[model samples]
Target: MNVIKRATAPTPKFFKLLRNIGLSIAAAGGALMTAPAGLPHGLVTFANYLIVAGTILSAVSQITTLNDE
Candidate 1:
């Protein structure tokens, strides 16, 4: 009897990059929220957008990566 195995494909590189960037953006957004003086209204709005976008990107990356397994 003979057995054979096939190697799986590696994860795409951009997903990892997306996850790291998303984390950094989210952290920056959180830091803005915690500043003592508080950020300007426009900047706060931008920070909120960043956090949302980052969370979305991170979730997408995670779901896609898991599916590849």
Candidate 2:
């Protein structure tokens, strides 16, 4: 399948949940990273990691497809 076809393909319910969770994690990380209040350096580093992990998770989940019978 082509990239566009694969990307638009139907995803399983469980993977859909994972994709949503990943998006939530990335949003939370973005908020934490950009908060006005002073945050610890370690936390900021963690936030960066969260963003990366979330992005990867979401991408992987999005690409998953159910087998055609």
- Model 2 stretches astray by more than 4 angstroms: none
Give the runs in model 1 whose Cα sits over 4 Å from its true position.
1-11, 66-69
lDDT of 2 by residue, 1-69 (tens): 776776799999999999999999999999999999999999999999999999999999998888897
RMSD of each: 8.2, 1.0
Per-candidate TM vs. native?
A: 0.71, 0.93
**Cα error, candidate 2, residue 3 (Å):** 2.4
Clashing pairs in 1: none
Across 1-69, the per-residue lDDT of candidate 1 in tens digits comes to 111111132335787788788888888888887778957899989889988988888766644432333
Q: How many clashes in each structure?
A: 0, 0
